[model samples]
Every structure is written in C-alpha cells, then in structure tokens.
Target chain A: MQPDPRPFDEPWQAQAFGLVVHLHERGLFSWTEWAGTLSNVIAAEQSDTPTNAEYYRCWLTALEQILAQKKIATPDLIDITTQAWHRAAHATPHGQPIMLESDPKRIEVK
Target chain B: MHDHPHDHDNNLDPMTARVRALETILTDKGLVDPKAIDAIVDTYETKIGPRNGAKVIAKAWTNPDYADWLAKDATAAIADLGFTGRQGEHMQAVFNTPDQHNVVVCTLCSCYPWSVLGLPPVWYKSPPYRSRVVLEPRAVLAEFGLTLPETTKIRVWDSTAEVRYLVIPMRPEGTENMDESALVDLVTRDAMIGTGLPQVAS
Candidate 1:
C-alpha cells in the first residue's frame, strides 16, 4: 500500500537505525553478521512480534549484543550510560537537550 | 500521527535516552561521528521511500522479459534495474495472480526489502500485523481495507534475514498502450507490500 512517507515514528528510531548502519561501515561487524544477530533477537520473540517502538528497542538490544560480542562494550557499561542519560533527561527542563553532564550521578562520581 | 513529537529531544523518553547513550558511548570511544548519525537519519527519514520499488513494478508490468527475470532471480534483476546495496541483499519477487494473491510479513522482525521498498511502514512492523497475517491473512488484509475474494487464495510469505519478498500486484487491465512512466504512477507502495492494490489507470 502507499503509506505516507514517515521513515521513523521518532527521532531516536532514526538514530538507532543510523547507529547500526554507521557501525557496520566502521567494520565492527559485517552487515550479514549484524543481520544474523538482529534476526536471532527477533526470533526470540517467536509468535509475538514487536510493535514499532519495541522493534527499535530490539534494535538497541541487538546493538548492545553486537558491541558486547566484539568486546567493545559490555551490557553493564551501556546500562550505566543509558541510566545516566535517563537521569539527565529527567533533570533537563522542557525544550532543552538532555546532555550527559546534566546527569546528577555524574556529580556523585566526581 | 503519534502524539509523541520527535522534532524536539526535550520531550524525552526512555528509548530516546537509551539510543543517545549508545551514540555517546560509541562517540567517546572514537568509533562514531555525531554528525554522521544525523546525516544517516536524515537520509533514511526524508530521502528514501517506495518510489524505487514502484519503478520496478512499473517496469515489470510493461516488460514481459523483465518480469521473467524478476520471477527467476529477483535480486539480480532488481539490481540490474539499479536497486542494490541497501537493507536486503537477498530478495524475491512474489507476484499476485488472479487466483493466488501474495502478501508479505516479517514475523521474525522487520525484514523488508529496503533496497526496493525503503523502510517498512509502521503498521507492517506492528505485533498484530506480524501475528495475524500468518494465522488469517484474509482477515488481516481485510483490516488493511483489502478484501480479496475467498476464491482468490492468499499466500503469506514470511520474510527472513536471508530473503525478503516484494509483492508485484498484477497489472490493472486496459493499460497496454500506456508507457512505463505512465504505469509507474499506478503502482503504490502498499501494493508492493500486498496490503493495498495499485490505483487503476485513468
């Protein structure tokens, strides 16, 4: 069907999509290997397919898996940063970009 | 169409931050370019679409030999037509006939032929569509406002990481004299997805 030209539902979706593509170009993993890892993660969903948001969430999960597999970063490392971003996002006022330095936890670490 | 406005990062969410975190981590490690991420996003978001696939569909309708090639080996045929090096490297052309209508769904993930169709529609990636398209294609298609006859057998092709299928909707009758470019206008993105039929040539 002729769907409206909406490539992504959200900006993060685009970032997630691009992040994988750029990573592949950097030689972290081949496209085939990336596809294989993504397929496996989606296969785990089995009969229950993901919603668009959840689908990209799967993308993020696969990215983490790929990075971890390559020993570039571990789940714990990503989780820490992800949580930090979450805190920063909450701390930031409306209409402001959520910079990582805005995270309250960073102050504790310092 | 969603309530979530993606234009501004200020109205934040968990997934948004999560991806940002990844980008930040990768950037810190000297493995990523923040600007490149924006560029890739812009290209996929605004530049790519199903027009490429529509061109292929139109060509197949106008050229019998091209149709044969598409039927035999879609990847090479489509690549020869100048659509390659995108999301799906392995692909197949699933033609819809008078008796048998073909529909595609990626029950595993969103395994679309991005080289041809660009990104899959949001509906195509939804849980309901991915599940119901297999168990009851007729019912699922009906939801998309495409109600094929009970006599017309509906075949649901499950896309895998290895091969993604593109549905070539049968050409509308009474367009034999139309040029390839004229025929292109009739082919809709949804037709290629098997969720919608092409517009009839006037």
Candidate 2:
C-alpha cells in the first residue's frame, strides 16, 4: 500500500535526536559541549554545503565523540556493542523483540 | 514498533533491522528510552509533514525561482518551507528531465525519504526492489509500470545511511493552468520516489 508521503525520517535519526536530549537532561554532557561539537561538525560540513542529512548526521557524530571523550561509551565499546547487537538480532526470532538476553556473547548469569 | 508479547508476526522497524538492533543496544545501556524515541518519531512523522514534499514539487513546477533555488540548494529551500527538524536527513533534489530519469533505491537497507515519502511500502523494502533496482533500473522501472523510451537516460540513485534523495518528477503536459495546490494533488508518493510518474493532467 502507498504509505502517505511525509518528511523523510529514519527511526534511527529520531532515536539519535532524542538520545541527545535525554542524555543532556541526564547530565551526561554539558549543553556547551553538545553545541560546540555540533557547531564544529556543521562548520566542517558547510564546505560541502549543508543539506538536511549532513545537518543532523553531525548529531550522531557529535554524540559519539562526546560519549567517547567522556568515556561513557567509548568508540571501541560502541563498536563491540554494535556487533553484539547484530548477533542478538540474528539469534532472536523474526517476530520477537530482540533482547540483550539473546546476545550470544552475554556472560552466563550466576 | 510494537513491543508486546502478542502473536503479531511483524517486527518493530522491520525496514531498518540494523538501527532497531542498535536502538535495542542503546536502550539496554540506558542511553535512551524506547517510548520517548517512539513518541519523538511519531510526533514528527504525524505532524503536518506529509504534504511538504508535494508542496515543494508543486511549487517548483509553478515557480521558476523556487525551482532554481531547489536545484541550487535543496536543504535551504526545503527549510525555507519550514520543514527543517533537528533529525538527520540531508536531502538532495533529483529532477527527472526529458532526457535523464532518476530513480532512488537503498541497496543496503530501506533508506527512503521517509519523512517526505512516508513509511516505505513493503515492496520498497523487499529484496527484489532493493537489489534489483540498482542493477537493472530500466527493467525495474518497467515493472513499476513506468515505461520510458530507450533514449531517456535512467540514473539509479542509491540512498545511503548518510543521505537521502527526493525525485522531482517532470510536470505533466496540459498542467499549464493548474495552480500550485492543484499540482500538489497530482504529485504521488511513487512519483517522488521515482517508481511512478505524477498523475497526468486530468
């Protein structure tokens, strides 16, 4: 069926966007850091001329950088977790919600 | 994106299993709340966003200045219409001309212009549509019931994780008297997706 047309949105983008707000609310990073990093990315991206995607992609990048810098979720940790999630997704059934329980790399509980 | 234990066979964010998977990881790590993300996406998607693409196309068809602006800078033009949001989705407008036809596909996953095109149809996220559209664009377009002449150059654009594309279809003939609002009605989601054409002036 024809899904009605709307502005182009990816669930991940919204999740990323919301994640920033939530993290900020939780005091994971200062608003100054978020703004500065995002501004730097936008400024760097302006050379290519900012479009919509590049505009917000900075959010994902800035978030990652900030998280990494703060050692909250380092780049290596994010990478490892991303792979773990992939494994979990494969382990989970098609129709079931993927859970960390299904992560094959998860340590056995006591 | 139902999280229930019910017997529903569908997955939440089926088109983007990878991102959904990442979201699960993030949730598990206390990086985000599932319900909040859902609310944000739902609010943005449902908020008067459905018509922005058609309006842009319609305006482009009716106004040369706006069309030129869209060609020069799609993001600014799109933002000028008050369509900008904090979310990622840098757009590049691709126009179908008499000589060059553009079609968009996401070879890796269903990276559609979801905000403008809405949620992707099942066929769009299907393996055949995703894999075949890039390899054999002409045949794929024909299967969508769009037949172009041999001379029209068909360019297949792949929407990557970093960027998305919008297809601005050629205004149909006999639409000279149609206003922007009237033209908007003629713009179909498929037309913007490059899978079909705008409704012929009728």
Q: What TM-score, computed on C-alpha atoms, does each candidate reach?
A: 0.82, 0.58
lDDT of 1 by residue, B129-173 (tens): 888889999988888899998899999998876788999999988
Candidate with top DockQ is 1
**Relative to the true structure, how large is the alpha-carbon lDDT of every model?**
0.83, 0.70
TM-score of the second chain in candidate 1: 0.87
Instruction: Judge candidate 2 at residue B176 and give its lDDT.
Output: 92
lDDT of 2 by residue, B5-124 (tens): 655322334324434544655676787787877666676567644467898899999989999998988878888987763435577899999999999887654566645665565566
Per-candidate Cα RMSD to the true structure, in Å, reads 4.7, 10.5
In model 2, the runs with Cα more than 4 Å from the true position are: A1-110, B1-30, B33-35, B48-50, B85-87
Query: What fraction of correct interface contacts does each candidate retain?
Result: 0.59, 0.17
Q: How many pairs of residues collide in each model?
A: 4, 11
